[model samples]
Target: MLTQTLPTWLPRLSFAPVNTAPRGDTLVVVFLRGAADVLNMVVPHGEDAYYQLRPSLGIARPDDSKTKKEERTVDLDGFFGLHPNMSPLLEAWQSEQLAIIHACGAPDESRSHFKAMELMERGVDDERGPASGWIGRHLATLNTGNSSPLRAVGMGTRPQRSLSGSVPVSALRSITDFHLGGDLRALQQMRAALETVYAGDILGQETLSIMDTLQKLDVQNYQSPITNYPDTEFGLALKQTAMLIKAEVGLEVSAIDLGGWDTHFAQGSSAGIMPNLMKDLAEGLAAFHADMADHQNQLTTVTMSEFGRRASENGSLGTDHGHGSMMMVSAAMWTAAKSTGSGLGWRKVNSLGQVIWRSQQIIVMCFPRF
Candidate 1:
């Protein structure tokens, strides 16, 4: 049999020069790939305009006695509520661990997913900003000296655009399968040969780091206390992310993508494709929250989309790409006292009635620890 090297697509474990000590909370960024219709996800039942605009696709108010429990939105506040399928997140809300920023999104006027996403990830409004990703730029500020091979990770085949920069990031599909795939004997021999050939060199150091990470992630002992993941790709990704955080392998930042949010057609209100996606997102996030309960203080999860859907329902019973979406921030440390009444310099909308969809800018809520 011909000997084969590791696949080219496999992430290369390398390190960037560190300046300051690694400090700060672990930031887990969840990108809702398709522009999620935040208007529906976080229903603004208080606004008569919302209902009037979204006639067919409008979610019923939380107090709507006529709708089924699974059909009506779960009221978060007097005005805003979550979609019925997103009931799983109510626990976080009630616990004061989650904060929803309504009518938030990038200021870019481009409704194109690619352009908006690129600009958002790059953390720039126009073409004048640096090419590096926001997270990557943030990582550049940290001094991660000789840290674990997995400092920053994107839980997918390709690294998320937000993680693109001077920092070395690993884009992984499956944590379990992240290894030299082939004959065991050949792998062992190649490893030994490489160790000898690059001993005391940077390559050798990175190789040793990879080995150490693999050893730490010994599949058997790293079981999560919370196991009820939805068996979807997003579920698995969150599960693995929790596992990685639990392992404490210097995971400062992790980016996970949950696609299929572009509800251009058949976007039902009470029941349909949107609800199912909400279920997956809620369940997966809830599972992750449960699994990482112990590390709640150290974990902060933020969800964002490129842009939001149009305020008005289209003729196709769906929504078109529009401005002013919402971003969700969940951190066990975010108390009502800390987040309430404090605008953190970001524009605050007291109610859905006050939200100016056209002028709304996506606010990147950075916690104190972040």
Candidate 2:
């Protein structure tokens, strides 16, 4: 029995009551806005076609003979490899906690970022699909009775389309700033007045709950166990997410965005724009995974983009919008006892050059347990 009403004082956002004993894993969805170039991110060193397609942009194959690892790819399975900048994620792969879904994307062929993002976020195959997001629908189906006010959160100025539905979700820029606005004396007066006005109703009760949550989320005093997070916006978002999870405030889902992936010019190889972004992404994710190691059994993180870059590089040394992209999933819910395979029954490519593109539908359908 989740409460769905929005408080008038907090008209900007909404909250939901979480079940005392909810069932299911907490989900973190990372949206790599501005289509990421999967081809170079996950290097295909074995494929000569890949090297030939973008001779300048392609990453160098893994070389044991080379003294400098920065100039080459980090071999994952001989044929396929990771961009050297993303070395932070190597451990996750080795431990089998990370799974890569190559050539995955929405069915729509439109390369427009807005349209593509809308389609993907809505979890619809066509333009006329339902308005509610896949995550919103998923939460609507769950039996989370009157859950925590922080059930689903979008970490930014606005909530992503994925969390749009009947369920109350919060859009947060910073947890530290989540409070009643006013100076010291004004704040005290406002709080006292609000308490008097909401003394004995659901609104008052929920307001008290929110106050308690804010106190619990005293982010200024929290310290992350992992120390390698990049000093970037993405890193900060993930750090806050970890804090919320550790607080056990009934956060069932979170959506974070990392933009600037639309590399259309001078996208360098091993030492350029792409590499820096890749480093930020890899380091942030790796740090989050390490910081939340104790709660890995109940956490699942997934990364997706609107689409992929063109198979071939453009004249500007970057790439244009392309058909197929990739998805990455790191889940503690998938135990060592379960099959390590993607479970989607898609063919696994081991060679660096092999291009596997099929009608895999968008990632919403690929969500675990959906």
Q: Tell me the spans in candidate 2 whose CA falls farther than 4 Å from its real position.
A: 1-24, 64-67, 202-207, 216-221, 335-370
TM-score of 1: 0.85
Q: State residue 184's C-alpha deviation in candidate 1, in Å.
A: 1.9
- lDDT per residue for candidate 1 within 1-370, as digits (tens), equals 1123322222233332332124335888999988999878887777777787888899988777887767887877677788888889888888888888766778886678999999889998877879999999988887556355577889999899999998888887788666665688998897788778877676455646555455445443444555577888998788778766654456788899998989989998877888889999999998888878878887889999998877778899988887777778888776661122112222223464333345345557464455
List TM-scores for all candidates, in order. 0.85, 0.85
Deviation (Å) of 343 in candidate 2: 17
| Best model number under lDDT | 2
Off by over 4 Å in 1: 1-24, 201-203, 206-223, 337-356, 362-367
Can you write out model 2's per-residue Cα lDDT over 1-370, one digit (the tens) per residue?
2233422211232333535324335789999999999888887677776777787888888884543667788887767788888888888887778887776788887779999999999998788978999899988998856455678999999889999999988888888666787788998898888878877766455746566566446554455645656788898889888877765557789899999999999888877888899999999999998888888777889999999877678899998777678888887544432211122222323364333333365554445533
